[model samples]
Target: MEITVHSSKSVKPDYGDSSNGDAAFASADVVPLSVFDKVNYDEYIFYVYAFHPPSPPTTVLVPALAKTLAEYREWAGRFGVDGSGNPAIVLSDAGARFIEATAATEFAGSVKLLTTGDKVLSLYPICDGAEELLLVQATRFRCGSLVLGFTMHHKVADGPGMWNFMVAWGQVTRGVAIDPVPVHDRTSLFARQRQDSPAQVKFEHRGAEFKPRAGGEIPGVSCGNVAVHADGEEVVVHRVHFTREWITELKSRASSNRGGAWSCTTLQCVAAHLWRSVTEARGLGAREATRIRVAVNGRARMKNPPVPEGYTGSVVLWAWPATTARELLRRPLRYAVELISREVARTDDAYFWSFVDFASSGAVERERLVPTADAAEVPPCTNVDVDCLLAIPFAKLDFGCGPPFFFRPGYSPAPVAGAIYVLKSFEGDGGVDAYVPLFSRTMDAFKKSCYSLTPPMADARL
Candidate 1:
């Protein structure tokens, strides 16, 4: 129930030698962060790994504890990204200024930590001029359980890339063969000078309206960039659990509604249902326009030569699906499901190529992106973001002990128009994790809304 923090331990990868002794590969002096890594890129990534029921008590020499820390230090260094203690990401006339990555680890204690499977999130990555690219926190609980969490700057790597590195680290912890090594070839995403790609050329002409921010661009946040806030307004995170059985029921309902003409994936089905429910809860007019913004991973979708499987840095973009609330709610859930699918399908190799060109335009990109995340008030149109947790692979991260009991993304404080995060369910249960954050009034009504009591929801909020 109580937690106390101590001094932080800075894990500076020996820049001279990436591997202090034994490492995955030889390190480089600096790994250039790709343009994608800078878009709306949150300075810090908050992730938690739950390893409960502590490895049965074992007798170990005092030196073993220190040795484990030393080993972890070396293991953690492998991800410091070319051994930079921190990330240098401020843009300046001098070809973009960057700072070192202070990726350090922390120690804490709790009496009731890991007693329950509730997912708690906090942004631990420091953002002030004094920043740490990555900060690992180890919390010891009275129950002898542990939750290994870390916050890393998005400048280093995005979710998918970060998790892949975690998986490889787990393999090393177990002394097993690691899978695809982490690749730092950011040039794969760099824009071309030839302007030969058709999609890239087309993207250059699209009006600014189609971009992220009206006049701003992506990820060019200020030194003290913070979540947009409102006067006396608040945002809260809620873990809305969807059971496997319920997802099946929704799919079945969707199939039935389609007269067995078509079927949708669990995500599409759930996304459709929530899209309608959230719209209704907001008390919006039936004919009000609503849209869903989804983050798309372009790693495998790249054309010709795709980004390597274990490529480092961010490889993501957004896909939008919009329709009037009346249209969305009036039609069967299948309609929205199809719409979401169609918009998502639009993201491919060509789309990514187009994105690089769009972002490379510089100031226009910044003009279009900042307003979306920084505007004092949201536009009249209702836009909700849906985050797919599968991309992060939280459940599969095992550090020689076992898979996590629970995992969740860091808390998001975006001004509460609304956002939905879909993640794998807790250990067992065979369900899904939907971390939804909305305006207070909307959530209050949502909990008691008919949607929560319906068959698809299984009448539970776990």
Candidate 2:
């Protein structure tokens, strides 16, 4: 496949002093601060796939690519913002290369984009291997020859906001005008803090010190942030689908256990199930201990009324629950659900705020505040290493087109055995998509666990 590059048609905004009665800094026009800014992290990555029924003629693919770019430009014009909060229409060099390189390759292979300082640029091809992650590749066996893949930063927008941007781009590409432009009003949900608050959450960045103790053997698999060395050799991803009815039942069970706390219960139950499955796969008894962390978005749960949906500020809170994997599996599912529910509920209480304040004040050492394995004792013998589940709502994201066919969050290798569960609406049914990154050696075990869920087959490149 061949790829080409082009200069972005967008322009940069000037930061000169203003005259007239207008305030020098207008809140409405300024780039809204995102919650990502407060969190120390790298970029957020996402992938999009566009499939054609059969290998469209080269004629169709080329023009379609061009139209897509034009549409992207228009969408960027309306929704894109610069660091200074101006009508920034330009794509970073990386963004430009992302679009161009995909086109040149005829949508084959992955494009790696990196952010350095304030600039985003595309790094050249890192591998000629099979398409994994965001790399797009074409195959003769499939009728659809081209797909679009993208990796962008979470600092730019949330899932809903990103969907809105994509829908706008789609409409533009289809040569239609989008009416009733989507609002970016997130003022209530993610309001910016007047000043920087010191980090309240802490983790012992053990780096590579921790060793896997799954049945006295470690799996041989390694990703950028995680590694497994063992006696196994296959890696695959299974997408599991759950019916809306099943989800409702799960939710109902969770509510009954928690006296009506919804999201927390649903998430905790799922996490518990996953943990149990991993432990069982490794022939570990139900009583082995494990810990799983759940990310909680604090915007809506804060003492103050939530920021508006369009508010693009930082308002996320997180929780880590440490318990024996055996204990989680021994109790009724509701017990685990209730445990999660109560933990999440505590974050909204004043006590949680006090903890945050105390931690920030340096009264508590980072080690004391963060979760740590009991070094004095042998680490709990557990099959599952570690897991994190995120349950953010992304269905109402309408940019005047419709919902997306697939939405996958970026993968993190830092957490040994991490997975992201997303609720996707398909044919008006709520389906759950779990994005998991595992040690390559445990591929068979992972597949077995996913097969039990029986999710429909959709396009999963990574």
Question: Per-candidate TM vs. native?
Answer: 0.74, 0.54
Q: In model 1, what is the error at residue 132, expressed in angstroms?
A: 1.3
Candidate 1 residue-wise lDDT at 358: 68
Instruction: Report lDDT (CA) for all predictions.
Output: 0.55, 0.39
lDDT (10s digit) by residue, model 1, range 186-244: 65446573545543535432322243444432231221112233344445556677888
- How far in Å is the alpha carbon of 240 misplaced in model 1? 1.2
Task: Write the residue-wise lDDT of candidate 2 on 355-388 in tens digits.
Answer: 3444345433443332222111222334233223
Where does model 1 exceed 4 Å of error? 14-28, 53-130, 189-199, 203-229, 257-261, 361-381, 391-396, 412-415, 450-462
lDDT of 2: 0.39
* Backbone steric clashes in candidate 2, count: 33
